[model samples]
Target chain A: MAIKHQQPDLVPLFIRYVGAVSSKLSRIHGIAGRDLEIKLGNDGVIVQIGINAEYSHKVVPDGERWTSEWGVTYEGMRGISQPVDHPLKEPDVSGYIWPDPHKPERMAEIKQAMARYHSDYAVMVDLSCTFLEAGYAHLRGMEKFMMDLHLSRDFACQVLDGLNTYYTALGVHAIEQGIDIIRIGDDIAGQNGMLVPPKLWRELVKPRMESMIHAFRKANPNIIVKYHSCGDFSAIIPDLIDLGVDFIGTMQPCGQQVDMAAIKAKYGDKLAFLGGLDTQQLLPNGSPEEVREAVKDVLRSYAPGGGYVFMPGHYVNLDVPLENVWALLSAVHDYRRYPLNFD
Target chain B: MEISTQDGERSMAEIMKSGTLEKLAQAVLEGAAEDAKRLTEKALSESLPPNTVLVEGLSAGMTVVGGLFRRNEMFIPEVLLSARAMRFGMEVLRPLLAETGAKPVGKVILGTVAGDLHDIGKDIVHMMLEGAGFQVFNLGINVEAHKFIEAFQEHKAPVIALSALLSTTMPQQKAVIEAFEKAGLRGEVKILIGGAPVTQEYADKIGADGFAPDAASAVLKAKELLGIS
Candidate 1:
């Protein structure tokens, strides 16, 4: 009902536990990432289509780096794959081959996911890291990418355009699979503010996002567009609303974006929000009672109208106390019903 | 060929008066790398000291960029551009200064704290610190507490900067601080912390010397910590 913009029986939850957290949670709960999320009563299930493996070149040994189809090589030491080399570092446009978005292997997992989970829970297709970030982080590396943005606007546009074209097709395919939400976006903002200037993002990323949403809507009229960014992006909330983003995730409440009530007051009617629990300081250091109180506060502030989902602001890291993690999940289950039972 | 000290100071004053320094600053503020590089070359040719090229010409420009970013007048991409433009000028001065053995303003060791892979903020702070004339040794993402201690010991840096974008990993800042104390290195160096979810209050609580919201402020805090202008 929340997805439909109507008040639901309770506030829904979306959990994105990744990497070290996933491994630890699996060990502690004796269940895997998705299974643990389901066991915790999440209303949605997200399955990553491992397109990276199929499109990637050869997988090296455990300690070696692996190159993707886009020619970005990533070292696996970090929790997430860190791009060490970009395919387009030389700005050699003629030799590069963009991956085939229509490849059958890429859509198989998404299809399988929709088949299994579409009936009981919300199925979200996460087509992530393909907006402006991949154009640089994967294709040209970050530092070089920024230099490219400053020095080579036309080439940068061409790179971002290629990504926009690919993701739109993938999004259209996901829509056909009868998913509830099609997730998009890369980490374009930082703790304090936008990583890309609003003007540059408006020029390069915003239009492409608008086009991608249009493509998704053209395919499925009722499908929700879920956009995710890692840091405080409240500076562009209005612009995101205008871009047809019906939902936002990992609202990592930092900086000026911490005022959840004000954000809900302004855009709650148009946008459904997910992930506001502080993950940096509170979840790891604060006590279980603090975690519980935070969960209550999040629901009180965001769950009032109709459109809000409960979850960690970002991927639950390994260092989060297991007690706080359980507190976060149980507190949501305990307090998220509406007419919210506030004691 | 080098200009005499008197001639260099006079040229710097002349450039400041003629608005050439402002143009250099404006080029960096606008993130025009070519213009920054060209202006630095011209300024050097006009017999300005390398130090003046660094402080007045390049650092002055990035300071404005940082101010705009703090006020939300500028965004990340523009900041990156400005930092890059400043890098172009620094590239000109780096080798020349290497031969002269001119000491850096201060030395710092920086990293994304243990268990956090987010490096964008750390990278920005690193670039901004370089432009500000600090000799920075960057310990890449997912840096452990001991690594910070080791780097501090190796470089004997006066300041240590830690970054974490994940709240879950933020406690590692305190842990890193604890490690410093256990190693008896806490008082030897001032610790500065930044990233999403890091606040000045948190810095105070963690016993860090200061906290900066962005790259520009990070440099200023480093300067303050080192008792340098």
Candidate 2:
């Protein structure tokens, strides 16, 4: 049987996105390298000190090609570092942590940054704390200082609570500044599925996520809350929807049993879908035509309704051909609500 | 009188020579676990040993499915459903076979490597191993090298399956493998590494014993490594 395609009433919806370098009011900005500093002040408000990017390449060559071998030179110590071992390629993209929430002035500064970006459309504020970063930091012996969600529930909650409080405060501030969307990113999935169990997520992570969503809703009843989790999360879709997350981002298409059409059918009404194109394959290895076709497939499968917003499954890696990136944007721009007549 | 009775039994055996075992096995391969179970129970109540039920019925069914999966003729969900059915029937026979001190047809220990907490692939591999008649010990996610080392020591697991979905975490699998090497237990255990970013080349580069692109192949690799026919 041919699958039925349902179209929405709205035609040619213009969804705003971060990460696209445009003249748009709320595009994603970056502060790369170790120049940035973020810390928790004693008074509990967060402070960010942005430093100048001294150099893009952290390692200087001494006629040795970097190779990550078993029992090889220590990481970040010598030679050209392998792409995997490079600090820039690490999973957590946020360069630094946030200031403590108890400090009023630090919070005010973030609030000011939030207001600056928030407009009538959605504005994204990507935060730095991630489970992977925490794990890596722990591997480097920062477990005592970092938020250990597994063993120390209280400490984890304290840290996440502060983070969520700040996140929500920013969302509220964004709303006050007339923003329509608030997106929070926490990489909870691996290429397979969750790094932690669903029960653990519900117990440890979901509440903090909920507090952010709820606080945002309290501030602006109409503001859309988007959350980003990569990999397969078919098990917790219901829980996330129930938690009032309006949109989900970073959908990896090739991982496990992910079928975008099925996901759209299941949760299209309750939650909007975002990021369906395969970044691992199409963005890095595919030609421009393949990229366009992939984008078209995503649009055909999930964009029939007003609820779908398309982006790469994850951030466009540095190695991704600029032409492929253009293919995606051009596909989005040239897509018209005619003939096929999808909303 | 005994000769006449034996002749009568031979006549009955001739009447049932249409290979019902192969028929039930086909159903299992098709992901029809319910149908497989129904037919299997019918075969079982007729005084067939649980091992025969597995060998001729469920295992044979899975062999076909596994072959198709390797060829890409079948997809993940289809293979997973079939594996689930195969596992359900295996669960019925596990204890009964164990009573005779028949260890699992194979042994496997699987975990998501330390610094990487992803478990979906590991869980799928665990399920696939169970379906393939292997006893699996799952150490869950973010598993440290010492924990895997301890588990390997305690279980004497012949096959160690390590998973990591991130590039950063992929290196941790090497650490666990190295720990095995340090303890002089590396050669004794076959190591299988897999995840999203993992490739056969990567596995070979890291000196892993095997690499499977998906869960279905993981079982096939396990069988080949263990010299299971």
> Each model's TM-score?
0.89, 0.49
What are the runs in model 1 whose C-alpha is more than 4 Å off?
Answer: A23-30, A50-62, A78-80, B1-16, B95-102, B113-117, B139-155, B167-187, B200-207
Q: State the lDDT of candidate 2 residue by residue for B50-154, as single tens digits.
A: 776777678777777767655545544455567657766776767767776766878899999875655545776787677677889999877889888899889
Error of 1 at A42 (Å): 1.0
State the fraction of real interface contacts model 1 keeps: 0.70
For each candidate, what is the lDDT? 0.81, 0.60
**Residue A27 CA displacement from its true place in model 2, Å:** 18
Q: What is the lDDT of residue B86 in candidate 1?
A: 88
Error of 2 at A212 (Å): 3.4
Model 1 clash pairs? A195-B76, A279-B167, A279-B168, A280-B167, A280-B168
Q: Report the lDDT of model 2 for residue B184.
A: 88
lDDT of 1 by residue, B1-229 (tens): 4656986768656755356667888899999889999998887777666787788888888878777878778876677888878888888888977877878989999999876767767988897888788999999988999999999888999899999876667789999999999999899999999987788889998788999987889999999999998
